[model samples]
Target: MDETAHALGASRTLWELVGRRAGLTPDRPVLLQGDRTLTFGELRDGAERAAAGLYGMGVRPGSVVAWQLPTRIETVLLSFALARLGAVQSPVIPFYRDREVGFALRESRADFFAVPGTWRGHDHTAMAERLGARGVFEVYGTLPDGNPGVLPPPPADGTAVRWIYWTSGTTSDPKGVLHTDRSLIAGGSCLAHALQLTSDDVGSMAFPFAHIGGPDYLVMLLLYGFPAVLFEQFAMETALPEYRRHGVTVAGGSTAFYSMFLTEQRKVPGQRLVPTLRLLAGGGAPKPPEVYHAVVREMGVQLTHGYGMTEVPMITMGAPDDTAENLATTEGRPPAGMEIRIVDPEGKPLPAGADGEVRLRGEAVCQGYADPAHAADVFDADGFLITGDVGHLRETGHLVLTGRMKDIIIRKGENISAKEIEDLLHQHPAVADAAVIGLPDPERGERVCAVVERRPGTDDLTLTSMSAFLRGEGLSVHKLPEQLEVVDALPRNDALRKVLKYRLRELYG
Candidate 1:
């Protein structure tokens, strides 16, 4: 390991890393949102106060606190405060509702739940109350504050679980994936090293603060001593000015983000969307080869996509110095300590260049899920986590994902379980059977397509009405089906009558 990597590896906890960075560059701006700026020193100070306040609220070390907030300065402070207090935190996506949020709170056994009062026309505080959430509190414009002297000493162990991230379950409920400070730090280290970033580079966070990528990105800034612009709600037009204003050198959330930037750049034909942007890097959804070519040719920027999931924030990332062919065709390469194994159905390792289930083991990998039943099924005998993703390692060590072992559709980097939507569709009176599949979409990377078999003598269901029905069922807007197709019956295997989603994709894709 290099000197920087060695130092990062030595970080015992996230709070320790933050303190080191603050001491190194006290006045360096670490976060920029609108007219507000938070330097490394200021971040430490504010978090200490917040930590004291949280301590006053009966949140002791190892207390389970859950928060559902947007990407704001206050959110960052609250997260860091939790870290400083050594509290186990579960962050829910701001868009999640009763179905997801309720499950998270119950599973995590959150002692306290923090929320924004009312945001984007939704009342999160009211929703928390409706769920009878314990210790519900609002944290929008201001967070709790108290004297730093009341705060307890920072956590010493990094291996203990401090984070619970949710993965959109293939079934009805989401899995609470467990992670520790060391795992998050290791994930960030892989990204920082792979991207070849420096303290001089300015970054942007367009994704949700509750997403796994949030901590992963924040660790990069803390490690490199750089600043990043925060977008509470990222719209291309509104975010463009901020990017230019901050002189962002690195920007992108996922394939969708790259497409959004390219769409804006194509509006005027030869003008760059953000002139200061040199590298567009992200990795939640699959990136088509064409998207890479388009971004480089039209936007005049280098595009580097990687492979990651909620369980592991980052596994493999395309470096800025990698060959164009490798960057375009593969999902880059895993860092030195990460072990990627391609195995057959029986868990036998496969040869290079052969497609199989992708299993990973590394310091960045999450230890397990909160539920023991779920944990028992995910990890193998060798301790490698079975990723449920089908991919192969090239002779050059690049990972090329082919498909998934589960029926999960990744639309714009968000995992939408096909089974969840299918179960809801089955509830509709006019639907006899339903199968949801992700079709290849250049703009979204994958668009959700629902194919249903109508009940006998019932009126045909339109896409608009189906969407409205899903909305009424409290499904997140992003998970709604973008396309609808009616058929007599869904293709199924003869033995168990299981819907063959791959066949649906083959027919509709």
Candidate 2:
């Protein structure tokens, strides 16, 4: 499968890849949603007609079109249609509200906007009108259609910037991240190669299709010639039936996803949750080693977690054949073309096993931010993307991330890794989730504070007990959380469910 993917990876643009895959397996199923299935041939033909329709609607080559839609078969067709027309697309998450949506529309200077009207009880069309977005249109149950003869030739250059992905923007306005067709293809190839998937295996996409991971996963399907179930809204109670019905083999989106599956498995101990599930794989946030071990032991499934960001979708990914220790501890090895370099604060190269910033230079990395001003400090003199993540590389070529550069907590002139404390806190049976942040303190430079969500039926989780538990786990005295606050649930984003540390800081500071 990897060899085939490598050969197919030679295609220049995404449209070419789509056409090639459709030619190879025209009758094979590509996407599965509810009772509807879309085949490879239908995808090619449908996208062409859709592209002609969009062209008829004034969407020509290089036209900027922004769409905010849910994960549906129509959404996939529209995206590929845009690809067929060589139009620049800015996909906003369906859950984004006025501030984020307005910012994206203004920043991308989108010529046209597509909305779903009223989805999940929200009036998206009304919101678009309120924002004064140009060329506003709704694509709920129907799409634009026209004769295919009117469309021009597809895009030939894959290197041109044709995608604009926004950062989470938890702290401020989101920056538009620029990506190309070749870069997205490289990222998906790296991920598909790492997962070791086959056409016989079934997959699932529980996350939003608007995310950068959307194209990453789509490319994987085209390369491997497999079908994946699409969940418009993901929840354990409602999603389990689909998993069982489709016999999903590969499932997961991030650490939260792994935990959700584990929580379900615990209800019926000693029995597989989704009898067909063989692997749980994802990346986007840190994975506590304990979570990995828990999934492997409790769910009886292999969990392969990778490291990725919007700027560079796939950095390092765990393989199925990796050692148990490495799989549980490290983020696996990078593929052939991806380069991982560790550097100190001064930008000097750091030796293996030394903690430093993780820098990347590879085909999968984005060209740069949409606004060049946001990219000034993003790249260093060596031209590697300066990822704000802090980690070290083992001699065995595995990367282990500790925490974020700005996430480090300093106390009395000593630096403390928040992840170190958070990881230990997760081990406590009473804690369901945790986030450690540095709070402002007058006496000390900064104080370590631990905000945690208590596990159900465990109400005795006080600060004193938490401190004693940490000390017993061999945590340093100074690194111990000075203040402890309990919340019903930790604040998280809609995508990946990554804990919003900045939100925690703002609330508890």
Candidate 3:
């Protein structure tokens, strides 16, 4: 967070690119976790020190370092630290299980890794030990015996990768998307300018810093010279006060996270709901109509929805003053210098209003995947990155995502996305979270089965209550789950978001 760090360099590497913003407002609060707060000056110094520490370790530039630590201020500092040295830093989401973590460690070819002695409910050292990395930093309360390895070369060309982001891998293996210095600045500038961020903005970052939204928010905040207040865990009660106390104006996250915040705000009807929040941007899934209305009606906060994936991230994003229908249903048109197309199964572009595989061609589209073989499969002959999503552009030119081609449930010859049924069930007040999957069936090839996580402590929620709720929501009789498993919590992958379709098929079969 050095107020004058950006003045020290002239290049657009992530280090210099983000530092420019630091000089503009170095004393601003850039990070806050629990009681630990670091201003822009402090954050910059910490990252520099962490970079120095890595440099001392002999971590050569252009090397890959996969760090798995919780969402602490230290994690954020280490990211820019690695970036400064030109080592492509990759973070394993703190909650990722062994299967997800192991895949990324091997796939990314990590040279150095940092993990806690213990985190949440798992042992970290044991996890990294199995991966056989060259170097490891084990720090929980303390790690005096950590290995500091060789440093890599800084960027000689703009084409060199600054970082590698892996897709969530809901239906297949994760693809490592290589992001260059130009792409980072392109994305960072787009997010910063679109959100109307300035040097005065104070961002309360509560999303998982490991994901695109969290890291993207931090980079954009730095590009705007704004300070971000980081949160280790997202809870509505504690989050609101930090925003009001810090005079935070911008909050960036998904609608699911915002829904939880608004749910908690209902209990305290005070001055801090939307106190001074000027910008709110949502990624991942768009907010449902009911949740979208609640934010506007109750808190008077307007939120814009954005759409992106790992390969061609940030394809389309809604504007701040966009209409309600746009916010609830579709993400806005593609950004400048980007062309989006609705394509048939054969990769031919379709006319407007026809839903097919969504594809993008532009500077924002990635160079290719980390692995050449995998790249050949997902990338097309013409070079457009094929997003597995199925969507169509309206007559107005806005994109409306209807379904994901891979997420389709193959039953009764009906193509359906799990999202369609999940969105329907989410309308039920008694339902906290729900996941739909195709299960084995005797007559039909497969049947719809829902693994639902009811709101905590709902012993009195009878099956009759759920049935009536689904009936009212107008869910097709065929898509209804024949049997519902009311569990304590939905199973989540390393991403810490619910996707139990893989597990659902296992159980029902």
* TM-score of each prediction: 0.98, 0.82, 0.75
Candidate 2 structure, TM-score to reference: 0.82
| By lDDT: ranked, best first | 1, 2, 3
Off by over 4 Å in 2: 169-171, 406-509
On a 0 to 100 scale, what is the lDDT of residue 204 in model 3? 76
User: RMSD for each model, in Å, please?
Assistant: 1.1, 10.7, 10.5
lDDT of 3 at 338: 75
lDDT of 1 at 493: 98
| Backbone clash total, candidate 2 | 0
Query: Which candidate number maximizes lDDT?
Result: 1
Across residues 1-509, which tens digit of lDDT does each residue of candidate 2 receive? 46777778878999999999999999999999989999999999998998999998899899999999999989999999999999999999887767668989999999999999999888999999999999998886778999999989999999999999887422335678899999999999999999999999899999889988999999999998899999988878999999999899999987768878878998999998999999999887666688889989999899998988888999999998898899999999999899999999899999999999999999999988877777687788888999888999999899998766655654533346677678789999999999988776633436789999989998668889999998887554656788999999999999999999989989988
Q: Which window of 10 residues has the lowest lDDT sum in candidate 3?
A: 1-10
Instruction: Please report, as a residue range, the 10-residue window in candidate 1 with the lowest summed lDDT.
Output: 1-10
TM-score: model 1 vs. ground truth: 0.98
For model 3, how does the per-residue alpha-carbon lDDT over 1-509 read when each residue is reduced to its tens digit?
A: 23232232224576665465566567777776666777777766667767767777766687788877777777777777877678887777676656557778888888888887677666788878876766888744432222224334445565677677766433435567788766655655556555555677777777667765556677666665666777776666777778888777877566556666576668766645757876667666534556666766766777776776656556777777677887767877676767887889888989999989987787666677777876656667776777778889988778888766567554432334567667777877767888887665433435667778788655545656766776666444545566677777777788777475667667666
Error of 3 at 257 (Å): 1.6
